[model samples]
Target: MVIIEAKGLTKDYGNLRAVDHVDFQIKKGECFGFLGPNGAGKTTIMRMFYSLVVPTGGYIKIFGMDLNRHASYIKSRLGILPQDNNLDLELTTLKNLIVYARYFGISSSKSKRKAEELLEYVGLTEKAHVNIRNLSGGMQRALLLARALINDPEILILDEPTTGLDPHSRLNVWNKLNELKEKNTTLILTTHYMEEAERLCDRVAIMDRGKIVAIDTPENLMGIYGGNLEDVYLKLTGKKLKEENNVENNKS
Candidate 1:
């Protein structure tokens, strides 16, 4: 049930390599995590998979189709919740959903019905008519989640899905993600939060300096590294502050 296969994937930005030759596979109905600190190129790799950014080299296949040749078809079955909120501030919560559904070619009436169901699913039914500007950050996150589901995609790609939320809101989002997993939805998530990755991912790939340094289950990674996921992450990545200071000193 391998839904995604990436072989020797690489991306370069001028002289800088954002994603170095990397390889990975994600199976159907599994929660896979990409973990790393800033500038690790996790997002760059994920963006390549989604076809937002073309790979500098190598191949990517989704659902048995070549990513480069069938990007539109692949995108049709993929749901993405990017790190930043891209919602239209002037639109109502329901309107946002309706607009997204149209991209999938769903009829207006059908899209409206689906939007309502999604709003209810995300506990935003009460705020269906509320403008995006008025909703709390948590509510907005929930709305994004709901919008991602409007097309009923088989694969969900979330980038820092719960970033910048309160504890309760984060929990709510996590619960919803779990529910989706129960329904056999395959998920690929990128996050800096070790706890979130540990809690949600069946397997995590730790990337650093544009390459994958480790890939294993949370428990195994922690066990092998002699501590929790955070400790393992730090051990693998070293201290970011020191790296930053070194760069600063080099400049001086």
Candidate 2:
């Protein structure tokens, strides 16, 4: 089933058009990725999905309902993992999850039980009592994942979910994401990591200069354009997909 549908989706900031008439559909239980170099409108598209930004043109339908008309209802079913680790540093690992649950109107008793389950799901049960400031970067990212799941959202949106993690830590998060996929969660993620896209996404939309240049499976894109996802990116965007080194300088 198509869980998300976008037609002529566009976003503008003053004179600059960040997302220009992009179109795509994401199916239920599918891992859909947005892969591109910085300033390619990848992040802008993500923000629109979660309603952080309003579109200047066209429409988005989530679960067959128009986004503009049903934003609150649509947002309630989404779990967003933003690029930054915006965790409540003042709270303990478990408390962080519990407090976020309050935003969804979950009861204290139910939130506590859900928090414990998510902590264990992300392998942070050992650090449940630890302060957020003391946890490693990877652990904090994992905690962010747990926090995002507090509402048991059907669509989980991640923006650069593992941008700065070490290799082992990246894999740990990947393993958790893989398990989530196994259970049929619809995932929408934006990443510069070709390997991450190849490993997680069932299909990817490759964007360039505010438009999607290609949309297909990694294997199909590679077969048509290059030997790997990086090559395909270079061929389509005329830029190499590095570690998003200038991410801050090139925010779309």
Q: Each candidate's root-mean-square deviation in Å?
A: 3.4, 1.9
* Ten-residue region with minimum lDDT total, candidate 2: 243-252
Top-scoring candidate (lDDT): 2
Encode model 1's per-residue lDDT on 46-153: one tens digit a residue: 788778899999888899999889888899899999888999898999999999999899999999999999999999999999999999999999999999998899
Clashes of 2: 0
Q: Report how far residue 16 has shifted in candidate 2, in Å.
A: 1.2
Over 169-249, each residue of candidate 2 has an lDDT whose tens digit, in order, gives 999988888988999999999988899999999999998889998999999999999689999988887787784546644
Question: What TM value does model 2 have?
Answer: 0.95
Badly placed stretches (over 4 Å) of model 1 are 240-252
Instruction: Give all TM-scores, in the order shown.
Output: 0.94, 0.95
